[model samples]
Target: MSAKPWPEGTGCRILQEVDSTNAEAQRLAPTLSGPEWILAHRQTTGRGRRGRPWANPVGNFTATLVMQPGETPDKVALRSFVASLALFDAFVAATGRVALFALKWPNDVLLNGGKVAGILLESAGAGGTLSHFCIGIGVNLVAAPSRSDVDESAITPVDLQSETGARVTPEEFLDLLAPAFADWEAQFSTYGFAPIRQAWLNRAAKIGEVITARTGKESVVGTFETIDDTGALVLKTASGRRVISAAEVFF
Candidate 1:
């Protein structure tokens, strides 16, 4: 098979293995001239939110894009929505089935209600502005960990190969992903979060369903309303609508 192609002017480094794409991105960010992508065939110490272990089998997709957003860290954080939408677009394009996938709140991509991918955004610099940000994404392309392999309480994992009954390599997946991400990132730059927010709600998983959001300290149960203007999750409870900026969601 031929090598996968990336978008024009985008720099990429593909590794046989790495500690973590995000960590490598952070280490290389200082010398990168522009937006660059770091991809690894396998990760020895991958991680997810809250420092949970992220399983990175050889055939799955493990990559990170390092860039300077030129905005406050809080503003750049909204790129999570952008990244989620990009993954949705890429998945649909790759599988040619829009009905099989959904975007979960915060940063997860689900297939038939089972997670197929996860997104993690980490940044450097203090105060308000961010010097650089690493958007790490892990997609289960050829293999997925069993529930037993990860924390038992975590959501069951899904793989693209099993769902579509076709073989897809990590490189093929990234070819579709890179351009989709660029498109969404451009839209976000020109139109702000309004369009991304609307697109996300359109593909959102379990909106309007009764669900629970678990903040580290407490859990809030309510009907999933919609995401507000600022991207906070809006949940309707007996009292009123509560906007949550960060939490683990369960439906």
Candidate 2:
């Protein structure tokens, strides 16, 4: 178990089951005074980005961190990077293997080049501010979905136990992740996204390597470049530099 203590002013609640942690965050946002971590051992209706169904096998880790971030939507969205760094730290702490992990662009963590975790961000508000923001995280702790479960071009899913022989529970993983997140969040709140962007870049996957970014409209193939200050994926394409705000990256 991680010796890391929980963050101050943060609330944590564990549920035996839920529809989805993100959904629960939405329901609890109105009543929450500070940040809260909602963890669910089982999710009946878990979903991912673009409303894709999330496969949550037994013994995996699933949770969401909800907060009433008073920043602009763009700023709030960048918290995905913060969450990524936290996951990286927690995974290393759990497995004692720092070199095996990498952070994928936007929001995914790779273990030995295979996907081991994913992050989904959801928020609601108007007038250029957010009422609440939730960062939903799902980690393959003990078991992963079959190869046929994901997209044809997607990276294969991997489990921590299968890969590293680490048997961390959902609650234990949360214990490590919550404090790590709070630390990165503190940096973000104090110094802004510059340091976070640099730190994330240092741990990013496929840097300077050829990759493909597919959006709803088209696919752009280019060398993986640095993420811009606004958290857009910057790629050096054949024609010119392309700054993609959103896309499905394949490497």
Candidate 3:
């Protein structure tokens, strides 16, 4: 059970099955009066960054938080960090082990040095004005895909049950996650991204360590310095400090 209550006026819906929660979010965006969480018991067509297939495998966690954030695209996008911090807190709340988890830059949560959860952001707009934004998250709670399921350069996937023996259902985990996210969202709303960036850095994986960030055919290898105020990944290369807005990070 979450120590904090769900944020007032937030809505939650659980479906026995769906093609994708993000898709559902897009469809529900126009009708939502406030932020809403959509969770699916099973996703027949789950997806990851770059439209890669995401393995569902039943009993895992798959959901999306949809809301109308009336902000610039860049500002709206920083919620990925907000979501990352919330996931960290929810994980700690579930297992009572803070030392076991670390957050990967950009949008991944690491458990025991392996990828345990991932975040994907999507938005709708016209003429550069925003309409709605969705943060889709997936967690390996009871099962993980085979090594062959992921790209060769990707980190191995780990599940909560396998790694920590914590048995958390999708619904129960959402109960923990939604409130944690609300708290961080409140912090972000109040103090801006300064506190969120610092908080994310404190729990960041590979901070101050050598890492590789790949963008298509190009790759930069450098020491993980920090995430800039704008949420860009800052790497200290021999050439200089490089700020990357998007890329796949590997340790």
Task: Highest TM-score: give the candidate number.
Answer: 2
Clashing residue pairs in all predictions, respectively, total 0, 0, 0
lDDT score for residue 83 of model 3 = 100
Better of 1 and 2 by TM-score: 2
**Least accurate 10 contiguous residues by lDDT in model 1:** 1-10
> lDDT tens digits, residues 1-251, model 2?
45487899999999999999999999999999999999999999999989999989889999999999988898999999999999999999998889999999989999999999999999989889899999999999999989998998899999999999999999899999999999999999999999999999999999999999999899999999899999999999999999999999999
TM-score computed on alpha carbons, candidate 1 = 0.96
Candidate 2 regions with alpha-carbon error over 4 angstroms: none
- Model 3 clashing-pair count: 0
Whole-model lDDT values for every prediction: 0.88, 0.95, 0.94
**Which tens-of-lDDT digit does each residue in 1-251 have in candidate 1?**
22234667778889998999999999999898788888899899999998889998878999999997798877799999999998998888787789999999999999988899999999999777788999999999888998888756567899988888757787777888888888888899999989999999999999889988998888999999999877889999988888999999987
Model 3 regions more than 4 Å off: 1-3
Please name the candidate that would achieve the greatest lDDT relative to the true structure.
2
Candidate 2, RMSD to the unseen true structure: 0.7
List TM-scores for all candidates, in order: 0.96, 0.99, 0.98
Answer with 2 or 3, whichever has the higher lDDT. 2
Worst ten in a row by lDDT for model 2: 1-10
